[model samples]
Target chain A: MADVAYLPGLPRMLPALLPADDNSSPWRFPQYFADHFSEVMGWLWAHTWLSVVPVIAGLIIALPIGWLASRHKWAYPPMMTVSGLLYTIPSIALFVLVPPLLGLDPLSPLQVPIALTVYSVALLVRVVADGLGSVSEETLQAATAIGYTPVGRFFTVELPIAVPVITAGLRVAVVANVSIVAVAGTIGMVNLGLLFDQGFKLSTDTPYYPPIVLGLLLCVLLALVLDLLVILLGRMLTPWRKAVRS
Target chain B: MIGNVLRWLNDPDNWNGTQFTTGIWAQLQTHLLYSVIAVLAALVIGLPLGLAIGHTGRATSLISGLNAVRALPTVGVLVLLVVIIAPHFHGRTSKGYIIPTLIVLILLAVPPILSNTYAGVQNVDPAVRDAAYGMGMTGPQVLWRVELPNSLPLIFSGLRSATLQVIATATIAAYVTLGGLGRFIYDGLAQQDYPQMISGGVLVAALALIADLVLALVQRYTVSRGLTKRFSKSTVGGAVAADLEEAGVEHT
Candidate 1:
């Protein structure tokens, strides 16, 4: 059972590595985590990068596009339509399609992050546009009256006001990306998703519960943490909202 | 790559097998079957619960919890369910795989439908409800006639979004050895057949686009024209906001 090959370059983390004297049920999570520390951390590290870098990249890419959409009212509909169409494509399909489109290798790990970045951009463009659009015309006029340049005013006044809205979009994108990274395991990309694949592959006779449970726990936990971080960032960026509420 | 995809799609051999279920047509049917069943099941369960929460305004806090459910990884939940439940079938024919796949898809679908319905109902103009009450409409009658009708645009948007998500996930059902367009991608990947894999991506994407288009048309016809026009004006922002709320993006 241990001899079945894994995806190339994937470390063979297995239940069989446990102590020989153990005869307990497959629910031995503490023991499993203790034994496979490096492997678990490795999965977590890869999962974090794949899930996060995309959101940051997407934000940077989307800001200008989203700003353009907000500025030119006519650009809003067509841009939203295109992004909506992009969003409808399944994550799994995008994972497979990305490599060929970019001339990357079939098994390249880069595909997962690139695919996720596409999703992030698709999701964020609307959020950024709407966030910026939410800025009151009066506020813009005030900023201009203060002699702030267009670019300066955008960064200092418009962007700060848009924080709550954009961050709301960021929270969703980050959380969604966490889950999507797991789907990459199906295509042999390494991440926490590999745990699900490993668990499935190992469960020939009876169900292997440890890795599956671990993967789910880690994923939900990661999503929750990342979500809270976005909320915190949003709060920090908009202390005036908090001040007004209080 | 385009030639490879064209040739692979054009190949007669790729379209047939010893049994009808082995063909692309059968696989497409299977994919739709799984998606429809899951969506219908979720609607039956979620619609009423959401409606109850919306109508009475009790237990509305539960909506946030439901929205958070969106963050659960689809692939993780699918694999976890299959592993936990498959053993109960004692290695019986693919019931093990199918049941779990359906469950995951159902779970994937419920949140948007439920949250959207709740938001839709909750967002109904209070004046309309007061007018209905003044006309001697009972509580249930108000919900059924006034609230439900008013909320159709949002409900339909929720349904469309849910349907699109369900279709995409149904493709992943192929990963667990179920039949769908995903089979082409997964099978092609395993065998290192890039054209077959890419074509599978094209087919799944095309199907999602068509499904979304059909739903949009249905929404256009079914929703009142006045509401549709009003929604179209702000839908670029409104729909995304509704979707974001349904996703539980705003805790405050």
Candidate 2:
């Protein structure tokens, strides 16, 4: 039902609004621009690692932080506030500061991923905190009365209740962080951002357009695709999302 | 550790400068001004557009597009825009960068406020709409008089959240070589002054925390108070929602 809301020709609008300016037609994108699909694929290949690694690292940290935050009432809020504070610090400053204390090259690939992971930590911590927090105290008390051990109660009781919120939070954080990693490319060991920077420097003749557009497209697609997965995950993981079996 | 932090917080002058330093107050004032301008700009653009989208059929498309934009890498965007736009503004001195920095910060602010307002308006009770209609109210009249007032509580939460975020993030504007507390952060790091860098970093972090707390209080006091004016909204919502259910009809 919701799918019908999307405009049928919505995908075509961007090109219509900003006509393709490729006079050089280096790729010779033939009868249909999609004919240059190989180029898009190539571009995707170049940046896929940068996008994926940071998101993966963010997830690994956020899941536990979210879980811990959700379980403890007092623990969740203060830490979340702290994390929120951490979330606001500009990435550039944070990166610059790290090299001084950690001896890590500020521009290193490891540095970007590490910085991105820290950013993701704030998001995940908040999400897990909120998700677990929403498990009604009534349900929690009921679980305790039934003799579920603290750990047993977490896995069996609280976690199930929190899954939907946690999944949604993870989805949002992933989308936000992946884009950040792309920015990391601007100053990293290897990144598509470097391509955009290169393209900008070279002007229209730059190898930038195809890669920049393709990279942006990839980023947008990842966001949309991941969002759908999160929706599906939510539906599968939570009773609330699924329609009652008639 | 706590004592060290306390020592920093305790001395009134320490807030603006630690021992015998001036310009701490100036830096603090500049940071506050930049954040305030950015947040206000975002609110101005976001609130009205959000109201329009929230109440219309076009909402889903607009909000999704905005979300996509919101997910954009802030640093990357700055870098990209700086290439095209920053050059025009570049001056022999730092002041030239201020306008572009504000413009970009404003761009960052829009999504949170817009999304929050949309969500707030969306959550407003449909029964309230019906009641306004029942009173022979026109659409805009109903929207402004009934829907917006009712949506205030949630809408304020969005603004609070967004503004707090803007305050934390506006520090990034310092990267353009403009002056703010962020300038301190960059300078501290470049000079390898941990105490000064940490001090600036810690202060900015504290500002964000304080902003979050203050806004949460604001959301509660102002937005909720605004809702009390429409005291019957919830009750009307319940009555109408129940009635609609009985009719085997519900509209999202």
A-chain TM-score of every model: 0.89, 0.74
What candidate 2 gets wrong by more than 4 Å, as runs, is A1-121, A129-162, A182-246, B1-23, B56-60, B89-96, B132-141, B191-196, B225-252
Local distance difference test, each candidate: 0.86, 0.64
| TM-score for candidate 2, residues paired by index | 0.65
User: Which ten contiguous residues of candidate 2 chain B have the minimum total lDDT?
Assistant: B82-91
Instruction: List DockQ, one per candidate, in order.
Output: 0.42, 0.15
- The residue pairs found clashing in candidate 2 are A66-A128, A70-A129
Error of 1 at A192 (Å): 0.3
Backbone clash tally (model 2): 2
lDDT of 2 by residue, A1-246 (tens): 567457433343234325356632223223223654654455455555545566567767776777766655567778877787677665545554454346654334466667777787777777777778788879989999999998899889888888878787778776766566565454433544554544444433222233344445556676677667777877778775465653
lDDT of 1 by residue, A209-244 (tens): 677778888899999999998999899889999889
B139-225 in candidate 1: lDDT tens per residue? 999999899989999998889889988998899989888899999999899888989988899889889999999998888888875
